[model samples]
Target chain A: MAPQSPSSARAALFDVDGTLVDSNYLHVRAWQRAFREIGHDVDAWRVHRAIGLDSSLLLESLLGDDADSLGDRAKDLHMTYYLGARDSMRPLAGARELVRELHGRGVQVVLATSASEEELDVLREVLSVDSCIAHTTSAADVDRAKPDPGVIRAAMDRSSTSGETAVMVGDAVWDAEAASRAGVTFVGLLSGGISRAELEAAGAEAVFEDAQDLLDRLDSSPLARLLSL
Target chain B: MAPQSPSSARAALFDVDGTLVDSNYLHVRAWQRAFREIGHDVDAWRVHRAIGLDSSLLLESLLGDDADSLGDRAKDLHMTYYLGARDSMRPLAGARELVRELHGRGVQVVLATSASEEELDVLREVLSVDSCIAHTTSAADVDRAKPDPGVIRAAMDRSSTSGETAVMVGDAVWDAEAASRAGVTFVGLLSGGISRAELEAAGAEAVFEDAQDLLDRLDSSPLARLLSL
Candidate 1:
């Protein structure tokens, strides 16, 4: 056979904090607890908007100039508080099975995330499908986070998947922004704080309620082909 | 008294890993070590090319098909091994003082990086000037890392700055590529693995030895006028 074109190999990249896992709410609670302890009043909804963004950017946006004043102490507190809640973290409904199914089919399944190694550990533990995920990304790995296509491109590059053949699945405008920048298809999930309108506006080709919804409607969408088993 | 034009308030963004800090060699070693233990014979120099990418992409590029097989255990090892060497990490020459001066002068020093919180903590401790950096990014913040501008844009957003007034200073091709994507000026540094030709090819506007060199010649460069204090 002639060599495969760069577009022949395809990959499906998923965001971990929300789309593939039900950790958005947990993150909100953790940030809420962290902020409250620091004597700052932050609404869960507001923090939710900041989810999917890099942690420092999220904190800086939420805390404003106070973020600078709080510095490492605040970051330390946020992580410390979040670690305490890690025991309860779980994969979003059908997420693990979906990833496993895709991996089984030889379609690369990567968890491209903004989570740190410590947080990735918690996710791996909670998901219990480490072997099933082809790759897991962390902040330590890339320069820019979501809303940038580097991670998605990285996933595509790793799997030898081309931008045209790859799809990025996530729950935030940032994911859509990234997929758009990478020139790939973006499938949005509503399990996170973002609304359908926001995801659509962010350039999602389709929006589903969560991993389960995407799974249920897989056959009806392009995701089925990209994530096919 | 009136609101300034967008350009008047623009800020300069700096990439930390290779641009401001001299940690690329350390990262290459860590990844090389991680890849070696996982039964792969990866060239450290090759790994250096993928330094600014997120973990999934890095692993994918380094491990290829074996990435799916090695899975998260290998990722865990990479993090564990990288963390072990964090203590010896340090900033590139004049990096700390330069970022501090920029911040002090209201230049809005933002660190765009792919490092996770744990890794960032190590870098922050080594640099010892966490309070001065306007923003610190990681893989978690972006859906992608460099060669993509999500983190840089986020930094601009957080500081209420814009691309016209912003400049991205770093030592790698990814940094230059990202700045190009974000519509910002890119100032390249020689301390990192990449060369001036490579940086310029990736879209860097000028090249310098490191932060100190940039600072030394700031007054005569377009960057000085753009930075506007």
Candidate 2:
């Protein structure tokens, strides 16, 4: 068989925090503050690497056996810190245009995140592109988070899309892992601050600089080809 | 941190079989043959998607618990069948030039693959760019194959390069996943027949249409920037 092209995609699943919004670094800071408040000091980059992971798995992957004892408290603390940090949250450049363009092209656009409903509301408020999204899957909708493939599956399911016709856009390794394991194509974006090499190694098919880069390349990008635009 | 540019790369780690040589389809066919000889039929894309996985993990991922019973037999069958399929193997377009170009640019080019020494010998013979590769790490050098990061680490170790100064180029998600976890930057090639989205999602900072496409853009490529040229 020849190399399969991007023409197979029909639905676009976007990982919100890092991919669409410039919140990954804030999440890293929040996690750090949360851990620090609990008398633990963790490296920022290590926290950055674990950004897209489900809160529980993120704690476990980073804390190892210690997670069992401290996960819940850290999660709560992080949430509190994040709520205050929300004011700094903003959609990445070209994010609104990219989503609106996908919608304009008749592609089903869905936001998939482990964020809670209230947090989702905040993000939606900032992006203000609610009308462009066809569906959304939040932490409450997914029993498991990324690296488990369950959230990706749930996101795809909500849009009635299959792996062959779906593409996941994320800024972290966890998002790529989820999309890869779920058999969906994963497109990586650098807007979230993840390195390209890290993103590629996680399983991105193609990567863009950010939402604007993707939007600018719509005519030449795999996403445009996938949408058959 | 901002999106990391590929300027940090000082050496290039290349995955041979599928990345440089056009052996990915042959792999899919071999697995299909081995599985079918056992009376089970799986999709070609399914087999293709699992190509870069370490052989042991490939079976476990594709066949689940049932692989525990049939793995040894399938392995034997695949080896037998692959020996015959080797005749069809060829280096991908510009594969040789890409290696030579990297070498000429003073970048340490190393071949990193899980292929056994014997299998790797066959691949090198066909690629015929032996002088371009500064180092090689076969399955013998690493206890864990790709997707485990050990092989990637071993290759980088031989060149005395750190993750920030190393880049991995391959055609599969497993290669990307391995590089991502190892903290190395990963560039992806489409010559292996994997989709761009899948490559990017797996964590490729960039994905070229093929080795030729990569060479064509070598002047402005991450590989060039990685070498500080």
Best by TM-score: 2
Error of 1 at B91 (Å): 44
Ten residues in a row with the worst lDDT in model 1 chain B?
A: B1-10
For each candidate, the alpha-carbon lDDT, in order, equals 0.73, 0.79
Model 2 residue B203 distance off true place after TM-score fit, in angstroms: 22
Residue range B114-161, candidate 2, lDDT tens digits: 888878888899899988788899989988788999989988888777
Question: Relative to the unseen true structure, what is the Cα RMSD of model 2?
Answer: 22.6
How accurate locally is residue A126 in candidate 2, as Cα lDDT from 0 to 100? Answer: 83
The residue ranges of model 2 lying beyond 4 angstroms of the native Cα positions read A1-9, B1-229
- Evaluated against the true structure, the overall lDDT of model 1 is 0.73
| Candidate 1: residue B7 Cα off by (Å) | 56
> In order, what fnat does every candidate score?
0.00, 0.00
lDDT of 2 at B75: 79
Model 1 regions more than 4 Å off: A1-7, A227-229, B1-229
